[model samples]
Target: MSRTIISSNVRSYFASLWTATLYHAIRQSNWIAIAVTGVFSLILFIAAEVSPTEGTWGISKASWLSVCGGVFASFLFLCIQSMLSALKATNRDMYKAAFNELVEKHGIKTVFSQRGSDDVITLYRKLLSSPRRRIWAIGMTNKHFVDQHLESLVHVLTSYQIDLVIAFWDPSTTLIVRQNGGRARSIIEAQSALEGNPGSKWGETIRQRQLRIANAVKDQPIRGDVRIVNVSSVTSFSCFIIDDDLFFFPFLANTDSTNDPTIYCAAEGSVGRSIIDHFTKLLQNSEVCTTTYHQKETTVVVPMT
Candidate 1:
């Protein structure tokens, strides 16, 4: 009777151990390792219980079985860890390779040439000539101040017969204008106000202003006309020109409260060169201006002129 009771207790303990191990493995999503360990543990438990010899070499069969079970479990756990490590390494390599390919295919190059003041102008010229779909300029202003600048810009473009559009955003207000006659309002702002009720944060406000500007330019009345859009912040003015047949050009300005005469220009030249190359291949004229200080010296690149 005592022998029977001891054997039953040993079986119950082994059963509980196996159940706990499986529970943990399942929780961790390691089904394969759990299965292997469970089968081996069951086999060890059975061998210990059914063995005819109660004691072999002065050690009980159950004691040896317990030790073997522990070693097997440890080995299986190591195997799972090894598999997970290998998978993680493979994923990391794939991500790196993908990123490198994208950079090679579409990454823009920066042109760093010239020295001192000339260097800055050269950089600006490059940016102005770079081929791009759109450019965005930002600055600072009040309602009347912006209107004055907008009138001047429209007059200049009209004098050149360049098709254009103007978009505006001021907190809860929005407006759009084209040469012929078209107007729209701030849908994004309205939606944002309804859904999130977001307060006036700098980033959010800037984003809203940009969105309104982009929408106005995109929905311009002309089908194939190039767009030159301008906007401002509290301290600066920005200009963006999107030309389908020409390279992109951008002009930025910081209002001189201290009465300084210095102006800065940032241009993407390598992109401009690429665009010129494409046009040259197609036997088309691609004229672009590469200059930093429009006030000091104007550099204009006209087609073979």
Candidate 2:
């Protein structure tokens, strides 16, 4: 009788253990639990069969317990698997919904045409979910010319209420400029020329051109909160974020007629990937991706800061 009671308690314990394992597996979407429970059940079944006193409880009772335990375990495993599948489906649906919302709100015509579209989209959705407002523009700068993309950039920054703008200057192109006839200038010098050019009519003409560009997009004003930063230095990380919203990187391309502008806009593969990796680390903590309008092969991953 004592043996019978002990066996009964053991059966009850396994039943409860299996039930708890099932609950956690289903709730947390953990697959490891299924394996653990299966192993544990196997061990229990082997012990029952090999124990010398098994017949003392009667073969009928032992068989019934074995069947019940197997059935319960199987049921729990199936239920957990079903729940996990459902959970995955639900997550995909939620991501799709959020992406659609972003498109409607910001007028994002397209996203993620590259190798890691799913991952990129997931990161993008996470970043957009945040309350922070930031915009980042990646372009080139050199001694002779600054890429004229600033006008479009200002419009984007303003629209996003960006608090900062990080501009990446590629050193490789600048080296090319130095090798050529032109010399590379510091960011401060470039910025001074841009914002506080000397009292020359030429400077004034450039400023007027800038103002006209700004005026053309009167519908979108530079956000009062935005500030420009020129990042001429390259670190282990190259990506920069404006208010945690936008990411920018330089891409290697064919240089134009003027050697000076080459450094300002030339894209170097090594430098570009380094910058992307850096930003990927930063954005991943918050779950975001660096997306582009024209490129289809690039994938942006947010890295750890």
Could you tell me every candidate's TM-score relative to the true structure?
A: 0.29, 0.26
* Clash count, one per candidate: 13, 16
For candidate 1, write residues 1-305 as lDDT tens digits.
99999999999866755555444445554556656676777777777777789755787887868766796777677667755654555456555665555333433322222112345434434543432333222222122223323333323332333433322223333435474265543433332343444343533554444443333333233222332222221212222223322212221221221121223222323333454344233222112211111110111111110
Model 2, 72-171: lDDT tens digits are: 5885876667666655665565567666665444333333333123454355345434325554444433212123334445455455544433333322
Q: In candidate 2, which residue ranges exceed 4 Å CA deviation?
A: 1-133, 141-229, 236-242, 246-305
Give the number of the best model, judged by TM-score.
1
lDDT of each: 0.39, 0.41
* TM-score for candidate 1: 0.29
Model 1, stretches more than 4 Å misplaced?
Answer: 1-46, 55-58, 105-283, 286-305
